[model samples]
Target: MSAPQIVSGLAEIADRYDAVLCDIWGVIHNGRESFRDACVALARFQAERGPVILISNAPRPSPAVIEQLDGLGVQREAYARVVTSGDATRALLAERAPGPAFKLGPDRDDPLYEGTGVTFAPLEEARFIACTGPFDDETEEPNDYRERFEGAVARGLEMICANPDIVVQRGDKLIYCAGALAQLYEILGGKVEMAGKPFRAVYDICLEEAASRTKTPLDRSRVLCIGDGLPTDIRGANAQELDVLFVASGIHEAETLDAGGAIRAEAVESLLRQEGLKANWAMPDLVW
Candidate 1:
């Protein structure tokens, strides 16, 4: 059978799906700010009986996500509830025996270890490493931490990734995430664990949280996972057997139509075909 047609507007697709599992970074907002129209669109959908859950690979818990969203001007009512990989990571850390952890990430990611009782350790004394992103946001590459990563690997310290996205659009620039660092560590023979979409653990948390609020049990068929990233978001949805609404305006902005232009329906179809995964619907972005 031919793949489902790409929908032109988010509202059209929203009406069809009972629940929305949305990615935060590329869909609703960039790292800097939240999309006003997208937030409005989600609020409107919820008002119309559709439940919208903000599922993200943020290296912080739901409260932290909310605080960040609040800083970005996203209202609490815009989403039903928030679920993030950081919550799952915190849970995993809590279950393990307390060990000195070397955090190889940004300061914003520190909240992931909050209340987990995991002791922070210096690179030389760390028992394991928890990577969230580059130490500095201004750096183009992770070269600044090359020595630290190498040393960690040399000492045989295992690493845990809070976010599984390799790169994300921070305004007009693409910056590396924790997944990039984890990938590099693994290449050097250091053990690494990921906590996010396509990894099962994070998705399970999202589904469980969504299930609690939803009046009706979330059916895989009636759900739509909307996101921009192919490897993480689209592939994860496909694996879960849920229909997806691929928003081409975020990470794939260059390949969709043009930089910051509406994603053509045909282009979305072709792109999905190349990836061997079909989105049930497509929109230029979350704009209503």
Candidate 2:
């Protein structure tokens, strides 16, 4: 039998799903700002009696995510609650701190370490490295950190990746993230750890947060996971046995989908077939 067809309109599938597990960086916003139409759609979903639980690989807690979203013009009421990788990282760091650490990303990304009591040291002096991204977003690429990873390894520093996204959409531009740095570091034989989705901890936290809000527990079957990244969002949802709605416009562009709108759809179907998982639907991207 042929695989299921991919639906491009979210509104067509919206009513079929009870809750939404949305990804923040790509579907709702680029790194610099929120997608206005996506936000409006989410608000409309909430208004229609469906709950929206935002799940992101962001390396900060919900409050920090809220602040970042606010700066990007996203209203708080767009979703019911938020879950982030940063919150999981912070919890992990707080539980295991006072360890000398080297931060590989920018100062803005350092908020994940706030109040964690983790001592920061240069690569030469640190026991571990908490990689968020390249030091300079404007100049550095993933390979640019090879030398630094070598240095950290030479010093016997283990690495922690705050975000595990290889690349993310930042206002029509693709930029490297902490995961790229960590992947490179791992390739060079550097010890690295991930604290986000596809890893059980972050998803567990999201589920817990979602449970706290509603008296009715979240039914995995009734939830719809919407996201841009195929590896993280789709794979993670499949692991939880939740339905998925792949958003092509976020990470993958429209051109990536072929004639009859079947290439991208077939790709997802093939992945699900291989993994023995299934997504209830797919969309180009969320629009108002």
Candidate 3:
């Protein structure tokens, strides 16, 4: 009901939360390199607060995500632990064990199936679909999977959408993700199960991990969710009734900023209203 508070850094509201559930891509990194300031902010939060968990919609397991983060120059001290959609999706798979699943992502994401007890099967022989994203996001789009999804739908295969993010910024380019494909399949009357942000599963893992490390029961009201995505990160936090600090310079920057690259505060309010999103505060970038 009130206009979102605009701030310059996390310090402005750092004392309000004991833990931080932070997004990976777009918030801390751009898929190519880590944002030093963002990483520093997380480290600072962990030092002062209870814990900081890097939550992501990446379809790979946490270890795999960590390896990638290390390669991307993300420091180990940035956060206490990482929680990923892949971990939540694997849990879902464990409940439906001993089934042949058709994996619809790149070979690099194979770690998602490491210990899930799911057999890899061809589409025709599979019981369900596990969608991470395209094999090559740089060149593929959701339409590229039209025929594949159509065939799967005809066979009544439900999809497990590992990443609930529709698209993410990769450096300077925007690439489609599993959510876009899942949405397309649903549009064509296919059933989908989501397991990332905007959904509660990943958040549950993050909160649990934070509490375990802190060795204290965490109050949801004392946690802060930091991200740049409206549909996934921001919406998910709002649904869980958690306060959020939104970074407006990521995916929605172009749409929320003036032609001169300044953030249009009124436009931001209108956009949040249109999308039915709520954030306690907003900043162009993460700094502390």
Candidate 4:
């Protein structure tokens, strides 16, 4: 119940951790491009700390995430390894009883269903649904999929939510993600299996990857989670008993800062309290 200390840069807490699990989208890139300072900050952390794992809720595997990063111009040395919600979701699907599925996202997310032994089927023929997000997040909302979700429900198709982020910042706009649709599906009495942040399965995969790349049993207390999303990133970090470095300039800027861009510590603290969340530090943005 302590107020989060506002800091100027990652330097204030960088040395306190052995590994840093950083979010990719809002932290290192804004979906359309990379954040130069944030990328440099992570590179610096890897040089000083044991490892800096790129943890994201993207509904694709690490390879796909790396490819996207490359396209965004994120440097190769920014982090030690990439761990994604897609990787975790793939494992979940692999372990499940093989069945016909309807992929609910765009063609870019088709990689999730690859080599999983789960054949793709039409909505009526599907035994389950693998939801990535809206096919076109830029123009579509969660309600756009209402009829499809209803069809899945009528067919008794359980949903596997690859990315548990409800929404994410894409440049200046906030776009809905697979989690938002999954929540709506649940509201209509459909069963949902989530495989990303705020869920223990994805965190387990990330922590394991951190330990693997660093060649050390990463202490959860010494591992810091850096992210901008409150519901997914912050909530997930809190569930895993790790300290968080909340990026105030991201999605929550309007709620946590004043008109002049000053940190409204009390307001930030109040928001966290309302969400039953906590972060050890708060910085406008991640910097070296």
lDDT of each: 0.80, 0.76, 0.89, 0.88
Show where candidate 4 strays beyond 4 Å: none
Residue-level lDDT for 44 in candidate 1: 80
Candidate 3: C-alpha lDDT: 0.89
Candidate 3, residues 46-67, lDDT tens digits: the string is 8877698999999988999999
Of the two candidates 1 and 3, the one with more favorable lDDT, higher being better, is 3
* Per-residue lDDT of model 2, residues 1-288, tens digit only: 245457755677777766777899888888877788899888887777477889888776678888888899988788988888887788667665887787777877777887999988777777788877778766779877777778777776778888888888878788888888888888888888776876778778767666666558767676778887776887788788777777767776644466554447666567557756556666666764
Number of clashing pairs per prediction, in order: 0, 2, 0, 0
Q: What is the lDDT of residue 92 in candidate 2?
A: 64
Q: What lDDT tens digits, residue by residue, belong to model 1 across residues 1-288? A: 255566666777665677778889988889888888888888887777567888888888889888889999997778888988888788767765377888777787778888898887788988888788888756847666667778888988888888888889998889888888888888777888876876788778777766776788877677778899987898888888888888888888888865557667677777778988877777777865
Give the poorly placed runs of model 2, Cα more than 4 Å off.
1-4, 258-264, 267-278
**C-alpha lDDT of residue 283 in model 4:** 82
Ranking by lDDT: 3, 4, 1, 2
RMSD per candidate (Å) reads 2.1, 2.8, 1.3, 1.4
Candidate 4 C-alpha lDDT tens digits along 1-288? 998999999987788899998988888888898999999999888887778888899999889899989999999898888888998899778766477778889999888878888877788887888889998998999888888888778777899999998888999889999999999999988999987898888788778878887766778889999998889999999988999999887888889878888888898899899999999999877898
Candidates 1 and 4, the one with greater lDDT: 4
Using all chains and alpha carbons, the TM-scores for the candidates as numbered come to: 0.91, 0.88, 0.96, 0.96
The alpha-carbon deviation from the true structure for residue 224 of candidate 3, after best TM-score superposition, in angstroms, is 0.4
Q: Which regions in candidate 1 have their CA more than 4 angstroms from the true location?
A: 1-4
